[model samples]
Target: MTTSFLPQSPPAAEVRTAAGGHRTTVLIGTDTYPPDVNGAAYFTARLARGLVRRGVRVHVVCASPDGRPHTAERDGVVEHRLRSVPSLVHDSVRLALPVGVRGHLDRIMERLRPDTVHIQNHFLVGRMLAAAARARGVPVVATNHFMPENLFDYVHVPGPLRPHAARLAWRDLGAVLSRVDHVTTPTPAAARLLWEQGFARPVEPVSCGIDLARFRPVEGGDAQRGRIRARLGIPDRTTVVFVGRLDEEKRADELIRAVARTGADVQLVLAGHGAYRGRLEELAAAEGVADRVVFLGFVSHEDLPDVYRSADLFAIAGIAELQSIATLEAMASGLPVVAADAMALPHLVEEGGNGFLYRPGSARELAARVDEVVADGARRRAMGARSREMARAHRLEDSLARFERIYREVAAEGAAVPAGGFTAGR
Candidate 1:
């Protein structure tokens, strides 16, 4: 709705600082990257490319694209795809098994001489990247996107052993993150969560941004819109769209139950694939509203805008999201939101301005709130306009500007911190 917060890229010749004589180069390390379809993967990929667009040379180290380790560069962003194995525990995630990053990472840095290293997550790759960078005073910046409890439901950890496992996980996360120069999460509430966990470092909140141009109100003609609505089987009914993995922590089952309780001819569209799909389907059938629920597993990026535009409102039952990129996209696409009040979602969805917030895991409360939007056409459009207005401060360029400032600051400070490793890579 507002591009005022968006930063304009400097002219081609202005890429370098007046004194520096050259553009800064950044090394972005991550446990995930594109084609993985999650927030971390998508954000990491975008961050690298976004930096490149802003006159920064970018390099990335990420999980292999196809389960095999390889190195490649596309669109001027050099990438080192390390060895990765599919996570049997959680099929969607991957584990990077860099046998000895201490040795190889030194070689990479010696050749690239990056201004700074930005690592995503506290996984194996991030731990090794942060260590190798800090050992040479590279001004490491770490961003956390993990929630232990969200993942615990997927693995087969016994109930009695859960407490100790969590304790060990936290211990490991702290050990890896403590060495970084700075830390960030997608929301301030998430920053507080990290603070409560005793993360004794600077914790900043930076949003995982969406491409506003790509997510704006769809531009299809009337006929096309009609066909899309018919194809989605929501010809003239109130459609509530939920876009996320069908995971237990997402609390998608609660959304289905709430839709059933609403009994207001509202349709629910589940727009991603996950391990919990079968259970959600079963729940829908049991609630006798299976016909009202549509599962369009894994919508493509090109087609996602249409899905948001075709809907009357957007809904998410998730409680663990630090920033719901889909919710932001929906807002950009001019739709009202209904979300859980927990975590950072409340930061995006104002109680009445944009939409409503229901108590986490409360089907009746969710239903009551959603029904309010469904029953009133005028209120829905007004709230949607408010949503678009609220999303202005979170534009992608604004986030990029924040990171650019962080990179410049770190790069300057990196020069003062003495390198802790051998300078000459023999």
Candidate 2:
């Protein structure tokens, strides 16, 4: 069961700190990172870059394509790529654990002796990294990103078998989490979920920040709107945008159904790609709303701001989201959101304030909310303004500052019981 997968360890001395007395180095292990473009990847990338900005040297350990072992510095962050199995649908990869690589990681950690190890995913590589860090007496911090429900979509397990699968997954996760000095979740809802699953680690709730500068709305005459509309082939009348993976969990299909229910002359633009694209397309076609729905798969990072800006409103029905980064981005772009009032959605979407919330899975209610926004230009404008102001609070720097504080606190605490362990049903 034990095998070492790494080719050869890079010289231990090869790893060195860059400018600034940031002597603190953090190793972020995940199954995905930049060039992969998922939530986990985006979070890790931003966190790494943010730490770099604070003068902390960051080293990323992530899965890369086979035979493509490489090293590079991005935004002052160093990435050490390792081989992984390619995902079937998306341009994603899964990290392969090798016993040999664990030794390499141990050597790297011994030399770097990073102040802390931050793990973003609870995958095989992450577990191995956590164990390695523990063995080296390095402090560990883990960010819980994925929900157990997401795994059920990929595995062939039946609904009845989910509890067992979830229990096993959480048990293994608890093992990795117990060894860590601290754990963080994007939202309180996620933290609660962790607690319910029997994880006794201190779980802090901190969100990954949104970039206010890039996401703010632009002030322009009809000319700008006209240009954006022309480019998107959307009529200037009304348009609703859903920016996220078009997966069943995201409920893009639900949004489409809601839009169809509205029967309003509004275009529905579906952004992001996933395994459920074809099914969503089929649903849209069957619903006879195919002509009204536009599929814009995998938008470029640079174009995301404009995409949000071009939309008249943003809507999401996914109840499983810990915190919808897309919703945050949309709000940052000054777009009023119509989100499900379940899980973490209510925390962000304040009804009649910055955005509106419908009951989770209620296509009729979602449709009605969409109609409300579309009908009142003045109300939408007001909500959009509030959204911009609210977004300022969650800027990337602020979020990073919170994390930086946690890092310092955890490092100072030394060996002790995790402070924030969850009490059942708290």
Candidate 3:
């Protein structure tokens, strides 16, 4: 487990730079940001806001939501949105063209004079920003929130060729990450995955963490739950809620199938939107559980906690999670989990303890597991308590403190390094 650190006092009013400037700034680069509605974007936004709360000046460079350049301050962090085009594969995704990306990044680097550059992926925006930062002697810290499986649907990689595609993806990831000052993922299992993928550097696991204060067991909010359910158009029933993008890799269809197999008085509620929504709704109808499956598309972050509190339990069938922030949020809300036995999920679940894990693609197995937890009220409450206890270890404050430490260390080191010292290599 990653050790939790108490947050230090906010930094001094100002810090002197090598050029004798009086400010401490961090520039974060991501291919996506708010209104993008994905895990990486959510994490990056939270990270930026958290740093701002700790008295650090934060600037984010990311793709514009509407194909036009703009700058705005939100949640106490400055967002530098670059001109972008809609992705060919996804309706909601936008990608910045690489043709003149470096020039734009260079201008931003020169303007912000960021003390450190923290990148959230190895995609176009992050890769270009890292190069520009390195060229200017700004230390770059990268956090990996990627798995090739997550993109296979969008990229339309054939099933048989997925293995080769994954290999190429990992190699390309490693090449970019190798040039950075530090690398981190959200769990120890994810760190191991980087090593196995041939990334020749020490990787640290940092829990994306959650706001424990806000999401807690709503001990007796039956009225509140009903109100939330009514708002979401979810029928009042024993509900198994899954909160995430209804993406192909998430396998929400499995949840629909499993709910049908249970043949019980339960509904599966999905609270996000994606390309898979139409197909999933069709599958629910085909499985004869269309009425029992509710799609609460794109629930805002503010309402997400109530969404969790409205559930009887939380379930996920995704196979590519590094550390599922949604799962953590559900756990913090005191809901027991039913998850797929793959990736970093095992790190969060204790079989038959706080939750149960079933075979990744077996709807029958998943049905049985979900039934086992929901049938016995006493066991369910006990498991929910355990889930809450487990969630305490991943408080968002601890994550913020740990990241601040890393930023300070890397920034101090960056001050001494010569410009253009970092070069991409395996």
Against the true structure, what is every candidate's RMSD? 6.3, 6.0, 5.5
> Model 3, range 89-197, lDDT digits (tens) per residue?
6776799877778998999999888889999989999999998998998999999999998889888999999998988888788778878898889999999888777
Q: List the residue pairs that clash in candidate 2.
A: 3-99, 4-99, 4-100, 5-98, 202-420
Give the residue spans of candidate 3 off by over 4 A: 1-23, 221-224, 415-426
Which ranges of candidate 2 are over 4 A from the true structure?
1-22, 87-91, 415-426
| Best prediction by TM-score | 3
Ranking by TM-score: 3, 2, 1
Tell me the whole-model lDDT of each prediction, alpha carbons only.
0.78, 0.76, 0.84
In candidate 3 the C-alpha lDDT for residue 296 amounts to: 81
Q: Which scores higher on TM-score, 2 or 3?
A: 3
Better of 1 and 3 by lDDT: 3
Lowest lDDT 10-residue stretch of candidate 3:
1-10
Candidate 3: clashing pairs of residues = none
Q: lDDT by residue for model 1 over 369-421, one digit each (tens)?
A: 88999788788888988888888878888887789888888777663332221
lDDT of 1: 0.78
> Each prediction's TM-score against the native?
0.89, 0.90, 0.91
Candidate 2 lDDT for residue 138: 75
Q: Give the TM-score of candidate 2.
A: 0.90
